[model samples]
Target: MNTRELTYVKAFNEGMHQIMAEDPDVFLIGEDVAGYGGVFHMFDGLLTTFGDKRVKDTPIAEQAIIGLGVGAAARGLRPVCDLMFMDFIGVAMDQIFNQAAKMKYMFGGAVSVPLTITTAGGAGMSAAAQHSQSLEAWLAHIPGLKVAMPASPYDAKGLIVGAIRDDNPVIVVLNKKMLGVKGPVPEELYSIPLGVANIVCEGDDVTIVAIGRMVIEATKAAQALGEQGISAEVIDPRTVQPLDIDTIVTSAKKTNRVLIVHEAVQFGGIGAEISSQVQESAFDYLDAPVTRLAAPFAPVPYAPILENAYVPDAARIVAAARQLVERS
Candidate 1:
């Protein structure tokens, strides 16, 4: 288990480097991915290592970018397309939903769209409403797409590699704020299977299930709750579509209380689906109702003051956990 500390962006770069070196059929295409090395520099140094053939820069047309990937993937090439910002996914919805997502099913398993779509998401740098929305829920709703949201450098590298190797169309949603966050990741190539949940910490009184950037906030809340004599367990569902509900249900059965948190808006968010499944599977074991903490239904604000209040944080999570535990 050799490892080194790397930032989320660097770990992703290493994963891409390794995957491309190992598979000749794999290549990356997206705006500024080759020369500019991506807006966040996540794909930095890839063009120099793999050369222009494997690393290509495309015009700022998301629809054309995804359409090329979809077509390339259907023809037996593994194409990793970058969308820059998840907010721009709406512009290429047809290529994503109608083409890449349904190609395998439409061809009756004769064709497999081994396409990987990577994009940056989350609201922390005042990027405005259009650029900072957490839209994994929309991709997860599609039947043929697999959605992953990594919280750390380790998961970031492993999940990207896993998504590229997977035969189905997979979307890896990276957090803009977590790009510089550091964590221990294996120096060697590795892959983390989808549909698995990481238990961040072990506790008893309450179970806190978090997604993406909220996982970090949930960890902070668990520590604060610990000092106050409350035991809180934190679970990170690394992938939302193929969610690991069994882990959450098992935790609920132990703690008898559950709290789900995410950066997405509460209404029709993934938290609602997780809540429904947890209650349905572990109804009799619960001592209290399942609760969720998320952003409001309004668009993401631009003002620093409003954005700070908009996204959930450690203090908010701690307060929510305390209230859930105090319920009688």
Candidate 2:
């Protein structure tokens, strides 16, 4: 395991760079991704390294960008398309949900859509409503689509590498708040399977299942709970669609309490599905109802204070966990 300190964005760059270097068919396409190195600098020096043939930039059309990627992927090219912001997925919903996601299934598994969609998600840096949203649940709801929400640098690289090699379409949602976050990641190429869950912290009192940026908040909440003699286990479901429900059920059974956290809204969020699964699988084991900590069902606010309030934080998660643990 050749590991080194790296930020989340840098880890993603390493993953794409390694794959593009090894495979002649692997290339990148999106807006400003080639020359400007992407809005978040995910493709920093990739254009210079790979040149225009592989790292071509497109016009400001999300639909066209994704449509081209789906077409390219169908033609045996492993295209890593960056959509800039997850919010723009709405413009390309037809291409994503209808075409790229359903092609292999519609063709009786004869054709493959090895397309990887990378985009920035979550409410932070005051990106406002249109630019900040965690819409992974929307993609996860569609069949034949794999969704990956990496919380750390290691998972970012590993998941991206894995997504690039998969035979189906994969949406890799990078939490924008985590871009500058640093973690120890392996320098070598590594691919973490899509359905595996990482039990970040082990405890007995409660289970906290967090996705994307919420994982960091959940971890902090776990630490705070520990100080108060309340042990909380933290679980990160690296992939949302092919969810690792077994690990989550086991954790929930052991703790007898579960608290789900995500940057998405509370109503009809991914947490609802996870909560239902846990209730069905470990209902007898749970001492209290499954609680979810998430943003309100409203557009992301522009003000810093409102945006902060809109996003679930460590304190909110801690309070929710405390409630679940203390409920009689």
Candidate 3:
């Protein structure tokens, strides 16, 4: 019942510590994860706590790293493979989509792959295109893969614990910019069920559904809209795969308007899917079209100024919400 403010990185580290201690079959393997404590220090103190047998550092080969996880998980071991950067997932696509994801299904449920893939994503630190990209949509599209994006310290810990315990392969995509953000988190081990939506702020005028770090921006936008007498509800879809469209549709039915936001490019993003479902389910309740505010169709810029402009902010959300609300 007690809680403390912990940064996203710290919460993530604590979750790993608790889960690894509780489950002997769980192990971590990734580049710089053991000795370096992860590039973002999300794995700090884990190596010391669990030792080299559990926390292992691997070569820079993502394919081999994922392959190792697939094999270990199929053999009854729980492996948390750190992909370092989500953008590098392309290098190990075969192991992920072909092997790890399809193994249990192809084997007729004879084998289970409790593989957890943790990676950093989203653009903010100007890591450039290669290092920063919100690719949750790609993983969510896969039939056997589960994708989760934590927007706060509490969800960071809860989702990580949940993902590690899931029997199927789950990808926990952490935003690089939110690693230092702090929020209330329980000291004890906890697991938030995936496929559930969190109603960050309640309202009746408009629904603002945001993913990952954009949830923070959407919350700010909601506050700003409140000042203008335009009540805005904010929802965070904790896990994209097995998404809780019922929560979203219910909110849309109440508000009669919906706006989805994300850091990924607008085209072919998860927002599109959410918008489609909302419109289909709540078409009669709608006063306006379901809108989406997201990054432009371009690579994440390296320059700070350009990157700042590239990523959507609270101002953009506020403006978009205002427009959607005004549309009658």
Worst 10-residue lDDT window, candidate 2: 319-328
| Tens digit per residue, CA lDDT, model 3, 218-242 | 9999999999999999999999998
Query: What TM-scores do the predictions have?
Result: 0.99, 0.98, 0.99
**Top of the candidates by lDDT:** 3
| lDDT, candidate 1, 70-188, per-residue tens | 99998999999999999999999999999999988888888899999999999989998999999988999998999999999999999999999999899999999999999999999
Candidate 2 lDDT tens digits, 1-328: 8888999999999998998988899989999999999999999899999999999899999998889989999999998888999999999999999999999989998889999999999997798999999998899999999999999999999999999998889999998889989999998888998999999999999999999989999999999999999999999999998999999999988999999999999899999999999999999998999999888999999999999899999999999999998994
Of candidates 3 and 2, the better by lDDT: 3
Candidate 3 — what's its lDDT?
A: 0.95
The per-model lDDT (C-alpha) reads: 0.94, 0.93, 0.95
Preferred candidate (lDDT higher): 1 or 2: 1
After superposition of all CA atoms, the RMSD between model 3 and the true structure is 0.7
Model 2 residue 77 CA deviation (Å) reads: 1.1
Clashes of 2: 0
Off by over 4 Å in 2: none
Q: Model 3 segments beyond 4 Å from truth?
A: none
Cα error of candidate 3 at position 71, Å: 0.8
Q: Using alpha carbons, what is the TM-score of model 2?
A: 0.98
